[model samples]
Target chain A: MRLSYPTNIRIIKVPCTGRVAIIHLLKAFEKGADGVFVAGCLEGDCHYQSGNLRAKKRVAYARRLLASIGVDPERLAMYNLSAGMGPRFAEIAREMTAKIRELGPFLQPSGRTAAPQATAA
Target chain B: MIMAKAKPLEEILSYLEGFQRILVLGCNGCVAVCEAGGLKEAEVLASALRIQNMQAGDRRDIQELSLTRQCDKEYLAELKDKMDNYDAVVSLACGAGVQFMAEMYTEKPIFPGVDTCFIGVTEEQGVWTERCQACGQCILAETGGICPIMRCAKRMMNGPCGGSEKGKCEISVLVGRDVDCGWHLIFERLKKLGQIGRFAEPALDKDWTLSRDGGPRLIIREDVRP
Candidate 1:
């Protein structure tokens, strides 16, 4: 089923969410992504075992770092979903897109809207 | 190993205020092992700084470098050719490494990225406990390998003072964690070694001159001199 999600979202594939380090998430924001999210396998269902959990921790850390720099920590988030939940994946995409839209475009510390860049992982 | 923690981001940013081009330097020695100041940490800091700068509408040039060990002249020599590229450096090494780097490159400003905590051992993946004070005296033989200077909140020579309760030091309340009473550990260790008699022996006042109080101590090994 070709469930449609917001086209603004760009997904970068990795072998596992564990492979997504803090730098990767921060770099996305540094490059001007309005929002970023790590879509990992559902907790306890990670193919590589604990990859999703590791991603969860890293996402939390990155969020704190973002908040420290005055960025909206809500701009970065992590979600867990199984491979079979394509509809839920689409739903999450819509939900995040709406949230980001309501939060408006991410502004640099200078208060200027950042140039659009890839926004999800 | 030396244990350290990152300084607050605001403090580090303040150091970079006037410097447009910055180098975030890391040490692959003790700071690396403790997960405080290493190549990965350097990258994370660099990225965060970049994001902060971009948000502030400031175009700051930030780069990263990691030396095998910043305290060694041989390793610091690697920066000889790269020093001219940046106006200042943010070092993630321990205090000694930062000082050594600052001394070598006198023209540029060097700031510490992490606060050096203590000489410690990794109790677990993310837990580190202070183990030594480098007091210039070794008394592990008598104390059963437990150090009193660093562990005991009061630096008790003969202790388990009234402040010690349930094997924890009174200072533990202020630190928000249970700190093992140094004397309690000593007693237990000495008992295990069948040297409980050592506890009865009075300890003389520690020689303050043998410690940092003596001021910048030095050692000369003629046999190893080139």
Candidate 2:
């Protein structure tokens, strides 16, 4: 089955979303990702027991980290779906893409505007 | 260990605002075990600062370094050559380490990244409780190995006080937690040890001058001096 998501959305897979530390999420924003989200295994079905649950907590912490730095916490999100749920992944990709569109470009550390999806293309 | 908590990002950011270069100095001593000012925490703070600077459209060169022990002059001297490379330092050490860094780098602005919370022990993974007050006098032997000066709300030498009830301190009720009464703990432990009769000896008033009231006391053991 060939499932297609928004072109603006990029996916970076990991062994488990638990591996996604708060620093990684913040680094994404620092490197000019206007929006970032984590897609973890379903809440209780993580291959490494409680890995997804830990990811959920990391997502919450990342949101607080974003808010602390004056960035909109809404730009970052967490979604959980089993590996068989391709439609769910596509759905979240579309959802997060729309959110970034609403947020537009973020400010870069060099006092320059980050290139948005359209500008990057 | 001296337990501490990271300062709010906003407060820490306020210190770095307008500074182009920053050094996040971390201590791997008591603060590390407390999960407040370790190398990992220093890196986290640095990342947060970078993100914050990016959001604010400002540039900052933030470096993270964790010393073996920031309170020691030898460990601090390791950074002497690199100290001039930054505009300011955000020390993630205990109050003592922060002061030592300030004294060592007189020209560089030093800011605290963590608030020195208390002299306590980790009761569990995330819970810490005060265990000592360093009152310049030891009375644990009399109190069944519990220091009332640290555990007691009022530092009572002999008491559960009039406000104690149900073996809990009144301050505990106000703080929305059941804090064990220091005197009650003492009495129970002494009774358990068959030493309750030793309570006949009245405890003398603690000398206030020996504490912080005298403004930073110092102990010099000349025999141990190198």
DockQ of each: 0.68, 0.60
- Candidate 2 matches the true fold with a TM-score of 0.92
Angstrom error of the Cα, residue B85, model 1: value is 1.3
Estimate candidate 1's alpha-carbon lDDT, on a 0 to 1 scale.
0.87
* Native contacts recovered, each model: 0.61, 0.76
lDDT per residue for candidate 2 within B1-226, as digits (tens), equals: 9999999999998887778889999999999999999998898889888877766666679889999999999999999999889999999999999999999999999999999989998889889988987788788888899888888888888767898788988898689989998999999999999989757878877787887888899999999999
Superposition error at A48 for model 2 (Å):
2.6
Candidate 2's error at A112, in angstroms? 11
Q: What DockQ score does model 2 reach against the true complex?
A: 0.60
Each candidate: chain B TM-score: 0.96, 0.97
RMSD of each: 2.2, 3.5
Compute each candidate's TM-score over C-alphas.
0.94, 0.92
